[model samples]
Target chain A: MAEIELPAGIMPDYRQQLPKFLKDYAGRWIGHAEVRPGVLKHWADDGQTCYTVRILLPPNGLLSAATVRRLAGWIRKYALTGRRTCRQSFELVGVAPDKIEELIAEVKASGLVVGGTGATWHQIKCCTSFVHCQNAAIDAPSIAKVLSDMLLALEEQKFPAPLKISVGGCPNQCGGGTDADIGITGVFRDPPQVDEEKLLAANEDIGLLISWCPTAAIRPKPLPEGMAVEINPARCVRCSSCAQVAPGGVSMGRERGAALSVGGQGGNSRGGPQMGAVIFPFLPAEPPDYALLKERVHSIIAYWLHEARPGEKIGSLAKRLGWGRFLAGVGVEDIESLIDDYYPARTVRRNLHFKF
Target chain B: MKAEWQELPLCRQLMQGLYPSHVAELSQTRYPLQMYEEGLKKGVSAYDYGGYISIPEIPSGAGVRTSRRPDILPESPYLRVLGPAGGWLSADTLERLADCAEKYGNGLIHLANGGTIELYAAREKLVPLVRELNSFGLDVGSTGDDLRCLTSCCGPARCDLALVDAPALATYLGQRFIDDQQYPGFPQKCKSAVAGCPNDCIRAMMQKDHSFIGVFRDLPVINNEEFKSWLAEGGDPERLVNGCPEKALKWDGHELFLDGDTCVRCMFCINNCPAIRPGRERGVAWVVGGKYGHRGPQGPMVGYVLVPFIPLTGEEGFVYLGDIFAAFLELWSEHGRRKERIGDFVARFGPRRILRALGLKAEPQILLWPKNNAFANKQGRRGGEGNGGN
Candidate 1:
């Protein structure tokens, strides 16, 4: 075998770059306690303590160049080490307890919020809505902004447990919304539309489009001129696979809205991590205010606050009380769509276990 | 320099009120927001999603993937640069990263959900960009059918609840498997993550194929002094005592007592009550086959805990774990079908058979007891038994 020259870069050693205090207490942290909503105090074995201040970012982890430069300055000034969290937030590590107030002020002055820790609403992770992606059924970023604006105060409020929310433009779910406590995914009630002219002009492989449908909804039809594809409305799940395959040939239909799913979490602590189950299969995604989506989320959180045990995640509570009773508690009517009959083999109920 | 751009009325409306908006930030990027505006006008993606132009001449191991945007941009293949495993970056490095983003490719640097930073650049400029990134102490990888970036939470460096040094472990495994990260030789894309503890702040157990989770076997330790102080600071004892999922906590007036047998170490008590801390004995749990994609037969799945506990001894603690991981990857690449995700493969091919193939003994942790029916009563068997008849 010949020696291959790999990419010349090695990851910068964080130990050499991190703040002095963090380097000193690299693997010696004993325990931590939340000082306030966004402040955390960690103790080392030598009794030295350091505080961490968390700053929140908007959906999709977007940051302007100016904002990035300012954040870089903050990282250089307030605390030497900064980290981008998995949930689209930033943390200023190794802050002295006394300087936390100053850092928070600096962050706020720069049009940023400083709370995503403790039992409150975390950042709303949304995928690129109509801004960049062609698969967007609903204006996800606008709706997410509405939700974030309404729930901004709750970022400090102590709920029964922390709530994670995600929004997807289409069912492809580029945002991984199904893994969140409250997942809002764009759905198409109708099937896709096939353009005969575009289909013929693109010269797409008709067989490929016919086979790529997850539900086999797309089928070939012989027109007078050539071959085209037709979609079966009942059979179609509107997954956008055909649209992605032949961009000019096929596309999703106009009838679109958002679906609300509840009780999903990624943590192994409470219920060992499960995908959220759909409660409301369709809700009108009116941008700028998204009143329906906001109302549904508020209702679910209210029910959680009223019923859930102190540290019990909404998913764990739903699992304990059963989805039927949990949805009823949120004033939701049990409907056929909630049962998820899409995959009949995997979801059939066999036993007599009922929580209703 | 900012490019010519026009923010839509909807984008402007969304950008109004509260914290900064993703729309505003996106508009500032040099990714041709005008094309997006055109997309909104036409109700379809301005950029084509068709398969990338095949470039067979370039080496397969190069850190590049084809990306094409019809009518607006030329053939610009993107690069997937590995992010810092520990999620730490110096301020100077961040500035240089922005500079790099502006200098090469589109001005936008996409922080992908998989923890890789993506930038769009033409094929001709990829080698120079990789060299520049290398000089800045960053590398390009985590694309195609190979090992993805090993992401980890900020462990003992800043977090107090961390039981293991997550960043260290991630760095160790990442360096050992650097070849895997750079090469496109796997049956399909493989992702891995290391969570410092079971809190799973990084969400590896639900999303990654290979997840190394920090675990402890003993009950949480309670400090009476801290408990009294916490109560004095208005921490509700009733909430803390009743919130335990396992009901393992008991408050006998002055001190807190725990039921050792009943406690499952779910971190509920330790999370709510700062007075309580995790146990002494700590190690990493090797969980495999978790994924978030809706593709494949099994759909999304939570990884099965293959080995309940693997002790961390010293600086070279991950060597043994790396050996096990490498062997599993080799086994998977040989047997797995093309484009088949690991979770689906594991579900189709039983976990017991996988364990047997790897020459490992299954513990109770590896079993999915009762086999999807709540009424069945059966004991979970180790590997070698026919999945304990229910």
Candidate 2:
């Protein structure tokens, strides 16, 4: 093999010097990098070095063809490759160490933020609530954008630990909000409106519809026209299962809102992974401002910042301080309906009833 | 400590089966104290060892955790090999995997519950093992909070009950989202699966975050001749009629009649008798938010059907489903909190707003019908009261 010589303090122009196969192989390379104050570096398995350039994207995860083309050009120029990061950011690899500042500036010039690492807020994730999902009960992306903008400053401000906020349009939780430090999901306060005529026309079996309800909210009715499905308003959990099972027969109620959960984390660290608990179950879906929801989220974050120990996640912190004290610190007064201690145990011996 | 089976009631009961009068002699021979003493001499402690040895690490990707079994000798790391959809592995691939396991691991391959193959190897051999796996057009993943391998049930390839090509759809999805599987980027792990029919042998609707289940829009087609023959061959007509959940099936001596209006299409009748099969019109229903793990907010839950029916006809059908999936991924990735699962996300966010964002109209199919308030006027009043309560 010919010994290819490279200039000192500079990276070789691999796009020109390396064979197409090697370049293609490099393009398929996938990995992670540690970002310092203003520099990023990732190493390959063979001890190859590459500088990282981060490109933060919108919560909707849409990138224009033009933006992708421009990014490709930058990758070609640096004789590097790009991989999409888990936090919805694109990291350009194999950039020359000297070109870090240049690449950052170039990416910034194209109206993209270039920071999503360290103790700061990594990325906000939203589910396809009401966007393209037939099951969505709320507008997830819009709320996500709003929340992202609200917490934009935190993206650069280094926290004691990483902070993540997720939003889902409904309880399906495509956003995985249950495992985030701060999680938000949409909710419905009422049952679906049933059209008897449509229900009969669709040949929907009332028995199946009744069985589909998770909350036992559905029942069959003998109307003058025929058999129709009805919902028990008090019993309905608003899971939307009935509507999904019988499309034309049932529809979502008019009253829709958002719910807030806290202290969820996903990792193999202390306390393991945890799902978020509902701190506030009903925040009306008032858009553009969502003032109530924002205030509550901010309060939780503020309390976490004040109380959490360094390197401790929100879930762990919640466990350490006790959920009651944590709620008190966050100034959440309503606790009657709080469902923090209801995880179903694997083995419940119904027979063991001890008289206390 | 004493050899007295006569004194110990449990030992007497055990000896009653075989020893009878020789219970004392058998008890003397079984020296539990001596065995414990020997174990102690061999460095075996009565207490379980809880700590683990730190091993040298390699970065496969973000969120991938190398599992360690300290109890086993050599402390081999367990690597999950992403398999083809529906757990189908060709002989060549299996042979290569076996060879790799023999050369680099403990020569043991464990088929995991998550539909992936596990290879127990040394930590140092993982990267090279993965590299070799890549050469065979296979990779290792589904370890951490990323998209796990797309699983499926045997579809039209083998099962007559299959309404769609589940394996093919899974393969397509696996290929399309290979990056999502290889790269751990989500707040938490996202799992997906495809089932060919409502039978759902893979349990996709209960175990996966997102599941595409085969559904028949129309009624089940009953072959009268086949039904008659089945009936003549001891297939009880009364049993089949009663098996219908809605009591839609009626047998009048010679022939069977189905009341299509009352049929719920739960597949009970079809599953009971082979003579009846799913209708010609087939589609898939998208279900979301299912999870078996109880870590999150709502605890363990079965998925809710999101879309009642999405017609799967041709390339356009795949594209339509793909577009919906892509949209979901984008939304969840961009806005989801770190480590949040889709189910928990939906719980926090109301489904109404999600549907609005997706540009989907509010469909009646996604709502729960009230069982008690059957009368329209009563329901209207109750609904009004419920709104006021909110």
Candidate 3:
């Protein structure tokens, strides 16, 4: 729980902590309170504000007055439209002398707890969920707010390397979470199951309604006394097809749970679709209960975090290892159903998985 | 109408003026021997497809596809085959091709996709020798930036999971394009493809600027009409579900359902379940950007989802798809450059931006998400497949 203070300067790098020009503004009062302690806002000579935070937290989470004064100088001089709140340039300088490293380390490890800083993501933020948005399929922000501390806890140390993670309220992939390293997109696994006899009694066109499933998961079947219906678990990817059909369809039986796939990318910023790969078939865990997702992600990615050569993107590991070796090395007895491994049995029979 | 070649009388001697000989549907011995006997009957050798298509044959040589500079061809040579690829030399055919190279033209070989080997010879020299080479089981064809030999990954006999008749499709497309290789007023020598599946082991995605990947929609549905038949037919629902990596399928007793959302439209389920049946969604997602290593950003590429679902079974569908791609090029060629990859060109003048400029719908769905590994765990967008392995 060591705290580290960041040096201040706003050039390309913000690590210039003890600068020559701001050496004089170290111990002064900007408004009423002492610029050096407690809860006080200190404005640089240029009228740009900096926060001289006195932290009772970790090294990565604390800041000091000197750092604030130094940062304020640049913000006032160079920050474009600094008055706009979304675009504020306050520094966490004059940390309580007890927790600077802890503060900086947190920034390095958990992007959420540390907030946005140089080269790191702005924050592990989110929007309201089903309780909030009419269309939200899962509880997004609650999961975000709940897991926020733990997610940030890891940021207390330098990561194997920094990567972006985001979450969304629905399949729309909004908030740019689909492009992030760890994106939690909420979706319904068990769509509304239709009660055929009841629906027909209500004058619903079950035959035509069956055609609407994207995976063609619905089909009309004969029932005993009246015409009951059947649901296709094979073709249903829990995309609300049944719900859309029944409207109040089955309430999706709690939460049909989640499916985890990997390999999505916006290409290398250059170009390339980079479609994701399937790592887990389906995990029966409900949203707001992201403990499962977090734990699984930790295990599956542990090898990546622990074994990957420094600076190697997780994507490259799959390519270099070749899909077969990658699956076997990770003890994944089977992965054919993942990203369409159409490679025949003998084609890559070098491994035990292919006996032919 | 004779099927054999040795019966023709005389072919080469028929060239009274410019005609060299006849190579098509010969009547036993090539009529050339008789034509030659009737005096030096000589005319420039003609061909079947093009009027007097010349095959100015040259002496054999080893270096073909290896040479970068285009060697000047002899007058009247309509086509050429260019290179040393995967052991083009069978020992006998090697020397003859090389001798032609040394005596007739540049000592080079043209590497070809259809496995044709050649050196550039004078256009005039092509006509006469084309027939002679054909007699020796060799034929001359047009070789330029436009015409590429459409091919496959050998086939299941030598490969695996060659579900579709890949060789036949490739041959069809190749022969079809060969006739129109110069006909289509393409933005550039447009590329077309016929890959068997996603493995695309042939690297067809990277080679041709455009390609067709085979996909089959076989995820099971709880259609007792179908599922009962499948299960009654001894179909194990467990095996089917186990077969799908995406877990797009599951069996809850008598009910069989297709996890449609998880399915990528691959034909595995269909291949596995004969009773499950395949739907009209049986074709490829025509991707526009899959090139690799030209200016190298791993060759910035993305296989766009153009023509979402097509029936690879019908001629109307094939022709319709052809027109779809053709129509796209008709518009794209107006803005593209010689060096720009189709995707780059599309991005520069994005589908939306271009549509607006051209009064189109600005379709953004064409943006293809290429397969990448680096960011899969963090940004991967699949179910049960994200880094969180089930």
Candidate 4:
């Protein structure tokens, strides 16, 4: 056996190595304003201004080695940089005021858009999809790409409020889809199919599988030679918990689609942080061009643009007008899935004290 | 050592429109593309969701598990390196990371939505990779049922609207909870985040189990000169007036006034008009029980405002915040069930109980709807009060 030389695990202090302007104005930043749509100017108390130029990355946030090297080279050539954003966008900090245009043009030449500032449509973010994660019900990246391409122009325009969108490969929502203004989550309709042979072969713990099911959908079924688990389809919410616990034993069915949700906002500006309510519970996960999905998104955006007050986010607007009115405004039919069935007593009003 | 490669048609089709296609990126690495191609052929995923190596002989091996431990690490086990707070990486660091990825298991790197850098590697190579990463100020963890990395918005370092140093706070917390980040002792994964201000660009409130949001306790100060200059520079007064959610701002042509009591400290004014700056008295609000996972009885939920205001004087403020975090983790670990997330645990015990346990008072900020008891039942059980019971 060879001895492994382990180095001391200490993360470097990024503040020490920050770009010149940022290091100089680390704590002296007083105020900031959007110089333009994608460009920003941060003012220090000493009257020094630091400029930042934001650019959109690919929806899935996947960068090849070559592209990463190229970005690193640009960072060195332009202004030295700092932190990138949480969203699917990259920020180059400490850009000179005189060189802002040149940097934007150079970035554009590399085939990336400079936008996602102010009140405009932000870059769409999606999960790893089936590319890496096995739990993905739909190819989320493809869907996100199609939507992002169509909505690229909106990134440059000033909207009523900042809008963000996310796509989750599954309801697990690794991409925080439900936290976005418009959330698209993949969902499976039916319960998992139990393979008794595989379950026995794999020596899976039937108890673990049964316990993993949130709705108690799995039950121990004794066979002549071995024991297996059975899924109660009626009780299953299709959360993929059982399948995750016992992969080869409990598997999800093929009836899969996407769920469209709206009115979600992460900020505490108006209605505070709230998850998007599922509007269209099930939409087909069509590939290449998701016409039906695009149509619904367009309609929702149109209604929001026409009806919302200036600087009002979708969630706050929904809160003011009521989800029902917003639904009707978008011409969506009220369905059973649209209602919060978790607690019937809470959601359903007993009296006729309703708005007509 | 040479890496094997395969051209996957189905993966290529799925990644057609994507820039720097993931498939193309993986194809240049040691990642097994045949699994993807075979899975695509079978209309399912090549990697097992249950973290088992895919069995080739079984028909629809979706249910065919292997002799691998189901606890952690998949077939092509990947290491999730905790990214710098707010995704801050130097150009040199980026080049090193890229080199590391190519030199080790695979050439491709995934900027995970959870604010981590994921790189695929074989089980045997994990040790050497971690050692290498450690040499360059990087470490791998955030796997299994442990404390995940604390992600924060780029605060005062980048954004001017920041009320507190969000990245600094996150880094402080991360350092304090380093042991938790490395060990998998918790009942379930605990995620945390810090937002610079009310404009939570990181979506911390709805995505993390515990979130600290930078907030101002006082009224927004108006710079009269800046205001006039902004107006002179074609700033829309109508839009600013109309955009106020609380109607707290009023302009009588000669002067612009703000109703202090009406303002909720939402930061809308500060964000829209540069003249309006956040009040000096700033601190972080502790919000707990937020999660995006649709698991357990209480599905997805936004966190409750546990503490409306925790005055942050300096580095000592981090100690106060850390105290609350440690207390909550202890409470959850003691009472929570196996595989139960903090959000579900909080839901079962009720926010009132949680506040009481933490020795905190319930403020009006904690209430989503004031004086609304529609969700309460005759038994006095609050909404979201039961465990696996509707």
TM-score of chain B of 1: 0.88
True contacts kept of 1: 0.46
TM-score of each: 0.87, 0.47, 0.34, 0.89
Q: Give the number of colliding residue pairs in candidate 1.
A: 0
| Candidate chain B TM-scores, in order | 0.88, 0.77, 0.50, 0.86
- Residue A42, model 4: lDDT of 85
Q: Which candidate achieves the best lDDT against the true structure?
A: 4
The global Cα lDDT (0 to 1) of model 1 is 0.74
Per-residue CA lDDT of model 1 for B1-390, tens digit only, reads: 234434465555766878667767777666655555554554444554423232332222244322234545543366777888767867876777777777876666666667777666667777677778778777777766888888899888877788888888888888888778776789778889899899998888877999899988777899989899988888887877777777788988788889999888888788777788888888889998887655555555678888998887455788888888998898788777666678866766667767877788888866667366566322225433323211
Q: Clashing residue pairs, candidate 4?
A: A248-B63, A248-B64
Off by over 4 Å in 1: A1-13, A129-139, A153-156, A192-236, A239-254, A286-289, A302-312, A317-322, A329-331, A343-356, B1-7, B40-43, B50-77, B121-125, B370-390
Superposed by TM-score, candidate 2 places the C-alpha of residue A314 at a distance from the truth, in angstroms, of 1.3
lDDT of 4: 0.75
lDDT of each: 0.74, 0.60, 0.40, 0.75
Best by TM-score: 4
RMSD of each: 4.8, 28.3, 34.9, 5.6
Looking at candidate 2 chain A, the ten consecutive residues that score lowest on lDDT are A7-16
